[model samples]
Target: MNGDWLLRGRDGRLSVYLPSGDAVLCRAELGPGGPWEASPRKVGGDQKLRPGPAVGQGADGYAHLVSWRPTKPGEAGLVHSTHFRPRLAALDWVPIGHPDKSGDRTGAPAVAVDGEGRAHVFVRNKGGGLSMVAQKEKGGWEPWRDLKGSDVQEDLAAVTGESGRVELYAAVPGGLLYWRQGEPGKPPVLEEAVETPVRPGTLRALATSADRTTLFYTDDSGDLCAWRPGGKPVALLASAGPGPVSAVRCELDGHDCTLLAQRSSSGRVAFAAYPTEQEAAGAWWAESGPQLPSDARVSLATDEDGRVVAATLSPSTGQLLLTRRKDEPGLALEAWREG
Candidate 1:
């Protein structure tokens, strides 16, 4: 269970993957709205599996996965998977281009699918700048292109906007730097980066639209802060631990919900709900749960009914526990499956 993870595929399937020996194993269900019947499969080959994977679904209905693939001991390269259907069969993993010689020193790659159904991958270069490879529409990959930035943090986030426009963000010394790619064929243009009120620890970003990109990070004081591009960063009263954070768009009671989840300092999972699409930091963050253990890794995806379904690893059993809320005001949590 070294490389354990979960994500919601673009087609509304909730998939979970874990590392087994040298391969990354996967399983998925249609949606968490009903009973879950998991179908397990292996995604990678004999390469060692990395824990976290960046997943995105293309317009063509194929889910793309990017993770580190070890070529030799201590040397790994960023690998990309073919257009595998997450709700069905297994993946035949393939290295995007030539493997980077840096080996396991590379960081995890982030992927986003354009509106044109092309996949773009971003990974950390040995020299610290970000390296990217674009998947062509006709069925191939372009040579790796370096998108140079100064002192870029390993983690990069991307989102697709209108017409497949892409917005990429990386944490820098002061704040974050972003780039906008108007079209798949054009080069990316760098934009003005801002200095935050406090130095950020790690970054979490999601783009709902071209104009509505959301960024979150822990301030130097360890309080969670949220910001949009060209907007001021505002701190949330919610305190967060060092775990990962993510947000998704789902429907609740006929309104759009921006659901944010983070691990608390005490190790319990905390969820905050913004009931509207036009979200302002600290506007209205509602919390609920059947709280999870401190070490649990949480994954969120929307069900067919447009409600949020969360899965976390149970500490005692090491099994994946599914949590959800019913149509009522209070959250009704349940254990839908194990492992």
Candidate 2:
């Protein structure tokens, strides 16, 4: 599993997947306040398939979901489904692709919706290679294309670049390799891997603008690092735990800022904001937010109004907590409040 269960839809509604005895796919959605509502119906699958689902919402107000499913008892692959109509009464789960090898487990699929409202699915095949498929404008998916690299170390980080171009990144043997699609309907071209000073762990990325993106990763030394397109790798903070870092681009006090959150080995989570790209280049990391337990993973997304929202999963209490940072004057880091 890629450890992505909670996601924010295009309309700012948050949806989460939970385990249920009666169904394989049980989803819950919550808005700004009040209670959580169950999706119209439960989506079911084979008994052998694990619930490693990844979801993405397109600008057209359609939500696409992909999850690991067994082709048979001993073989595993990915299944694609979509929710388009106002009500989610029935979903069409299609058999998209199968693993390269039998009994091989595939990671959770990564999805990106382009400016044209086309959905792209990137999955790490069981052979440790990366492959992709896209949704056609009219209906159905195109053929699966193997982007070809047998050494991908983790789930891919992808974002829609400026002009509807797609960019994908993975942590490989010596460094990170990136691929950018030439244009719509053109094959993606792979670039040379850029070596890093420290061995990278899982990668997390977000597009700050059509032309700019910020990449974050946990290093072998458990420190948090940041990198941008064609920029030098910089360590943002030391002693960060092995947990994944969540980041997003938003307006902080009416200024563009990139907010980052990471957990520490001491069982506390800290958040910081870099008001400008130049400040982030200087590693000007200021601690923010109340300390949170280290066991949970954080997922961050920005709303239409530029509000930075965070969802954290607490393993000890089995609670999913939602928090948002307060917009205040000055450049100092501020505390986050529960909704």
Candidate 3:
């Protein structure tokens, strides 16, 4: 899944979750830039899981993960698991079933936690529309609710804004579809669809304000673009490769900035830093770190010190590789280390 895999906990430690074989494995930091765990630990129970699982951290510091398991051709069942603190033990994978009772066909799922500390999962339904289920007050989940749309493509992006309202975005045939919560803890209402050409599987959302988010995606020409609600899409710069881009907001030399990372066409990771919500100012791109498989996905997160940490999977060995931004100025990264 193009969703986030790297997450920094409230205690300053980081956790990287990835699909290994039929299971989800987690390699967590002993501390910030840790000597991580000696080896990865398997999460959930013995149940098999589909690759590209989507992970998100809640306001309460728990890591929530969502993935699907194939039951038959064109049919899969969705399951979810949460990471408990102190022991770092993951709860058993609980099946959430499908939005469509007749058939389980669905796109990759995306998860977001609202301000009230409830986790919400969104996935494309069998009808090419969107369906969502959120954690209930005490426990369990509400029935799946269909947030209708047409020709909704996968790689859905979901983010909870500073105000505790959750926003969701999806790519359709000729444009993008958006959903926004009128208030915290309320269901999101579908906004008028914006007409823009977004490459499928490349949409991502980052909250830039208390009630708003900036959507990022690659255009038809593989150029990076950003769009905010009630505004037109702004082209940022050309990307080195065609895929989803990872973004996180942090301080750079005392200035608030948004750091972006993506896999380059040459199998190397590229980075860029732009003033937060200042896409009109433009961005400069540079390549850094070792070259990985051209198809390897990259994700970014900030440490307790506000430094950016990056993680990707080794295609050949299926191991986790990590690097963090150096203390020096600019977007320099430390040497890659296996977790």
- State the weakest 10-residue window (summed lDDT) of model 2: 18-27
lDDT of 2 at 317: 49
What's the candidate order when arranged by decreasing lDDT? 3, 1, 2
lDDT of 2 by residue, 222-258 (tens): 5677778687777776635666777766776677777
Quote each prediction's TM-score: 0.83, 0.82, 0.95
lDDT by residue (93-206, candidate 1, tens digit) is 777753254546566667777877778887667677777788876987888877777777766777666457666777776677777785566655676587864343356566
Instruction: Give the alpha-carbon lDDT of every model.
Output: 0.63, 0.63, 0.84
Candidate 2 vs candidate 3: the TM-score winner is: 3
Q: Which candidate achieves the best lDDT against the true structure?
A: 3
RMSD of each: 3.6, 3.8, 1.7
What are the runs in model 1 whose C-alpha is more than 4 Å off? 1-12, 30-34, 37-39, 50-52, 59-61, 98-104, 197-201, 275-293, 314-317, 329-339
TM-score order, best first, reads: 3, 1, 2
The local lDDT score (0 to 100) that residue 259 gets in candidate 1 is: 73
Candidate achieving the largest TM-score: 3
Q: For candidate 1, give the lDDT of residue 24.
A: 59
The digit string of per-residue lDDT tens for model 3 on 218-318 reads 98987899999888889999976788899898888888898888889888888899999998888988887787886588899888887888888764577
Cα-lDDT of candidate 1? 0.63
